[model samples]
Target: MPRTPRSRSLRWADVAAWRLRRHHLRGPLTAPEPWQAVKDVSAALCGLHAQVMSSAEQAVAARTRLPDAGAAVREALWERRALVKTWAMRGTLHLLPAHELHLYVAALRDDRRQMGDRLLAQQGLTPGDVAVVLEALPTALGEDRLTREALAERLTAVTHDRTIGEKVRSGWGVLLKPAARRGLLCFGPNDGRNVTFCAPRYRLGADDERAERSTPTDPAQALGAVLRRYLHAYGPASPDDFARWWGTGTPEVRAALSALGDAVTATDIEGHRSWALRDDVADMAPAPTGDGPLVRLLPAFDPYIVGPSRQLVSLLPHPALRSKVSRTAGWISPVLILDGMIGGVWKAQRRVRHTEVEIEAFVPLSSGVRRRIAEEAEGLLAPGDGHGITVRFA
Candidate 1:
């Protein structure tokens, strides 16, 4: 495939560079402090899919110039209450900016799933049983956070249903995610190895945690707002892409994007119809020659890699090799990106004082590309920890 501009269409290369700029992936962001840098990256991508905490931290570190990336993530999440970690989009764990959590939740709470009912029935449970759990959540989750087992006990005691307790105890968020998406439940700080749950108000540290429910966000308006943000970050995309990323039905996403009307502009990318924020159409210039950010690495499940509407071309242009990136059991491999396309896959591990990285490229890498990959790997290190990296190709 010739990576060139098709006549009368937005240059895919230009779109790639523009998205890199939007994601702060073009280079390190210079911010006054750490949290600001972290928030900037998180906000740009809507939020970080924090299925793996280190991957989420590296997602920010690689894009921003932070002295101590890990500490900064902890401060926002644990100390400053600036970030909220919860089950978000597609029912996966995410680290969202505290201020923006409601926007995502507002859209999510309104989008009901038939899967929940089906799962409930499979467990011999009913909507009323789940409703009782939802209603009791306000009280069950108090000022202090409760572990899953602890919360299960409370729900079982309150609902007086031993079956529900067993289901909650045995399952991995199957019964609980409904309350989570409904804004009735969220993750609390760790209890050693045990994961805890609490009300969103409590984790956010609002006074009267139980009483401080946020004002309801209009689903239509909220969906509209989120769609605009998505288009800006991952535009030249379709509603189906957004639906896949957002874990919602295509019809709802299509309706929301249509509702945007003049706020969005339709365009073509490689002959496929896509839409972008109308105000941003002018900024979509053609890509300059030479590889842009030749060898950037994205950790597993990084938003740019897992994004529904992003790195476009229906999960990369190489449909033949899509299985390597989008693996089984919903695992997105840590990828090596060459000029905004999935060039290869890579993995890294910390070995005491040094970090070891192995790269397996789909096509041969030039000397220049190899050097850039080494530098990109070095950037993943923590400051003042004797930053040393060993790069190997497999």
Candidate 2:
């Protein structure tokens, strides 16, 4: 029998530094053009949560050496076409690198759209109606993209069912995520305030790219690939962490881990056991306990906070204060990290003249640390967002 890998004990500091490095938050990507910045950062972080476009851009900016967050992100999205924004990963909007669309869509098996038959029935939609819309999506979104309203009208025209209108009304776009997973629909460039939809170009010739004809053609393999990617970016995570992140169950995650075989290794952070990519095992070094606090202001829903199953207590050790970080109705507040632990929670409110970032620290902060936090916050500012940044403590 093969010997089990030794479980490495990790400190919260070590976990914090490693995660910050993996996320490109320790320091931005060396240097990249507007387009490459988005692609590189998105690929590195699995993908940026795009529910709030500004937040997604800030996340990229935090990871990249690029000057203007808006310029770099929009250039990659609209001009370079290097990134595709779509509903994915727990049926939420994400900014994913364009070249990896095939891998992501393949992992999201066609049968695994977000809405179930019961929910469809609740919307007065039948499976047949959903099928008709899924089939009609590609043709309607051909060549140019269409606004949600335009697509809804065309869907109604094609299906001859007015209920399709009810399904698309919510800004959340919960019902349409299924079609997006099928690779037939994605968010197109914005027409002023209106968001559009298009069929993403999933056939890229990147080194890792495969034709629809995959080598294995096994869904588990794709699932395993996704797990490997996630582990690299946010590893030393529990099986349940991946399950929750992917909206999967224990058995599915177990099988995916099994598919990795020796590619993954077990590890422990404190008393909690988790898994990490084999290659990453060698890099898990404990940050010197004597080192001064390190700080970074992460935007709301940054992959770092959402990726590792925050409930693990590794992110925020104080159980009573958990509500401050992860709030009601799934709101993850922008956070301040000190020496790899949740030292505080923060908010960046855009004022007409300036953006004020108010921090509520759970522990006292030193002047040097506060100054560093201000500098970090300035680097994350998007172009034309505000002329200046003010840091306030509460």
Candidate 3:
């Protein structure tokens, strides 16, 4: 396969519009059944950042029309087994569809190895120690869910290594993540306040068996699938962006992009080299012309804000506003996005009866925009009384 010819230069506006369109924010919202909606959006965005469970649910609710969408998301995880929370790209917890687990696990193989090495060194353990835990995990977990503490006890008994049990009980998830990446473990139902773990095979049950029978287990093919999905949802991006997003080396990302061949087209975004889907580049010429600003109240760690970028600081311009919205102690706060730029920071507090949403805008927002922000907050608190939602400008 030959590489697609480079398209004309793309501006910031083009990239922003492409993001909105690709994120399913431009057109009429299609409200599918709750589980289907979660699956659709999760797959579309590659995976949902689930470090904060409430935030992940809210992110899905913002895209779908389901009332009490958050509850539905939980149902999908605890009941339907449609979505599985596991350590994926960047070695962070994410909600990936159960059917696609194999692909993502395989795609993160290199990064997982690197992370495992660092973690093992930090724990003063060897690869042999990790293998012992891995070997014991499946039978220890069996068809039952075990809390981290309980699982650690089992590991201690099985491996007969007190240090392994101590590390597991420490809750760092260092040794456990390797097992997850290798498809030996995943999140199970919560045991009261504590989270539990079980084998992916046990969690998926018949679904896992079906997937194993049908899904290709080739790592190279899985890498290609992940790259294609990433580009589809967050393209017109550079290999550096992909590398950053995946937490993999740039050389590996470039190799995957190369294997994609003409499926990806090279272009210059804001004077920086980038790549996008061939069809997307063909349609993005002249960009999506519009002057009306689009306002979106995106939750913390939303995919739109988390996607790869070269000049995010320039998008906000103001130093203080940039700091507020961007990383601060590894936390990406909820943001108010106006026309593809980080316009302000927002925080929400759910009271007993109502949800209080406070917005801190970098620049004075127009009355209409403020109303739109209020409307968004109301929608976020929906299936509950709209009047119960309060939006305060700080």
**What lDDT tens digits, residue by residue, belong to model 2 across residues 1-394?**
1125578788766777787778877667854467787888888988889888887877877777577777788887877777888878888889888777667777776435356788777766677766777787776667667888888877777767777654666424655778888777888788899988877753233533543445344567777888889999988887889888877666777888877888888888888788888899787775554556667787898788888854436566577888888889888788888766788899888788888889999888888888988887787763444489899899
Off by over 4 Å in 1: 1-8, 122-124, 205-216, 286-293, 309-317
Candidate 3 Cα misplacement greater than 4 A, ranges: 1-5, 28-32, 110-116, 205-216, 285-291, 309-311, 318-320, 383-387
Candidate 2 least-lDDT 10 residues: 202-211
Who wins the TM-score comparison?
3
Which prediction has more favorable TM-score, 1 or 3?
3
Best by lDDT: 3
Query: Can you rank all candidates by TM-score, best first?
Result: 3, 2, 1
Give each model a TM-score. 0.90, 0.91, 0.91
lDDT of 1 by residue, 207-297 (tens): 3232225533788778878888888888867787788888888888888887787777777876767778878878887445466345688
Tens digits of per-residue lDDT, candidate 3, 1-394, equal: 2354555588777677777777766552454568777877887888899999988888887777568778888888888888899988877889998888888877665454456566678777777777788799887788778899889888888887788898788747878887888888888878899988888876676766677676556666677778888888887778888878877778777887888887888887777877887877766643343644687788898888877644566567485566676675667789887767778889988787788899999878888889988988887665665448889999
Question: 340, model 1: CA deviation in Å?
Answer: 1.7
Number of clashing pairs per prediction, in order: 0, 0, 0
Q: What is the C-alpha lDDT of each candidate?
A: 0.76, 0.76, 0.78
- Quote the lDDT for 338 in model 3: 75
